[model samples]
Target: MEYISFARLIEAVYLPQIIYTVIALTLSCMSSHRSSTSTELLTAATVQVSSDNQSPNSGNPENTYSDIISSSVHNITVIGVYMVIFAIAGNLMCSYFSGDACTIISTYLEIGGGVPVLYSMDISTKIKTALILSLTAFGGLSALFQSRDMIRISGLSFIKYTTGKIVCAFLCFIFYMMCL
Candidate 1:
């Protein structure tokens, strides 16, 4: 059996994720900073109108706080609905497939559930390693679902983030192949 050191395992598992996260965060911060200037200007104009009108409710901190809380709850409800729908669809698909195909689909749906499946597969070590690294980089559909709220709140483009994940997965696969 081939033995892998702890450092190597950590590098393989975390290096690509860290690299992708750093790049994504940098891009997100730059874009948000640019957009925040415009948003701040618009907000200032609106706030000035509320102040000039001398509306008690408009300036009430408690009302504003409640509004923010309600909006957050709405957003969370929407995300939860999306997650439920996705889970249902994934379950239906998984039920439709059998054996290896089902395992592969499950892997793309939920990484945690799929890892044991991967371990039990009678596949070559290289294929297993590549799949593990690439899947970890891509983070599966569950990760996408979990990150949807964060992506929306951050004002980051979903398409770009997904593309980055694909690129990172490819890079991880390449890195693994190179190490062999």
Candidate 2:
């Protein structure tokens, strides 16, 4: 679905930047905590590289490749866990409100799945359009949870991120109404 495709595109473009930012922030925090200057940190990293070059297994390409692969796997596993948690929470919330297990399950198929589901209902067009746009803007609790998990490591305030999302959603709703 278009939603899944868009999600993948967004993830591909933003996830690496996010991971890099987290790493940089973490290193910055650690350096500050230890009273180590950036120069010292750079020197330490250089020393580490030189030491790695001198290690017994340094000549083995397979070892280095496997290390890279393992780290990649670890990152993938963390992402998978985030997805699972998000799915579970979405299901719970959807069930509580809709009281229909089938509809709750199907909405996970795409970002705008709810639009089609809402269309089949007997609701008025105005209410349906409002709900569709609202859902599209909110992007579900799963997205919120995933984003929170991603940025939590950088010691960033989750409240600000959440507020931004809500504000964006509200603005989108307002714009939609103004157009009508």
**Candidates' TM-scores?**
0.59, 0.47
Q: Write the per-residue lDDT of candidate 1 for residues 1-180, one digit (tens) a residue.
A: 566677876677667778878976687578977568647756765676557556467768898788779878987887666556656666677788777667666676666655666777887777777777777877877678778766754545577777887778777877776774
Candidate topping lDDT:
1
Task: Give the worst 10-residue stretch by lDDT in candidate 1.
Answer: 148-157
Off by over 4 Å in 1: 14-91, 98-102
State the lDDT of candidate 2 residue by residue for 1-180, as single tens digits.
Answer: 013255543443344345545765686687765445545655666776677557577689998888789868977786567667755655566766674445634443234445577667565655455445655666655566656654554445578566655555555545444544
Model 1 alpha-carbon miss at residue 105, Å: 3.9
Off by over 4 Å in 2: 1-68, 94-120
What are the Cα lDDT values of the candidates? 0.71, 0.56
Candidate of highest TM-score: 1
